[model samples]
Target: MTNPEYWYNTRTGEVEKGRQSAWTDVMGPYPTQEAARNALKTAAQRNENFDAAEEAWEDEWDDS
Candidate 1:
């Protein structure tokens, strides 16, 4: 059988074994409890990385 995925409940800052909260208040299908627990941190880092990449891409096309 497949293992159950973990989810981070944003509303209560808890790590759940599976989907147990409203979709709007949860953050994942993370592979482990630790990952789910760090969901906000992970998301912030990813957002920063994506923003940096987007800025670089735009800079590459600027002629001025």
Candidate 2:
């Protein structure tokens, strides 16, 4: 029952979560949890690299 630490990357327009430091395979520390995720999101998006499911992208589609 927590905020789950989310980040919004302006560079890539991607949102990411920490999911816990251990499972995330991260170093000791970075900036704020939100900052860390934003950094990763920016990097991934810069390379056009995405790991989430295709269904997830459906929300971004415009039906209107």
Q: Local distance difference test, per candidate?
A: 0.95, 0.50
Q: Write the per-residue lDDT of candidate 2 for residues 1-64, one digit (tens) a residue.
A: 7445554444444444643334334432334665665565557675564545444576567443
Best by lDDT: 1
The list of candidate 1 runs beyond 4 A from truth reads none
In the range 1-64, model 1's lDDT, one tens digit per residue, is 8999999998899999989888999999999999999999999999999999999989988945
> Which ten residues in a row are the worst by lDDT in model 2?
21-30
Number of clashing residue pairs, candidate 1 = 0
* True lDDT of residue 19, candidate 2: 37
> Once model 2 is optimally superposed onto the true structure by TM-score, how far is the C-alpha of residue 40 displaced, in angstroms?
18
Q: Model 1, poorest ten-residue lDDT window? A: 55-64
Q: Give the TM-score of candidate 1.
A: 0.94
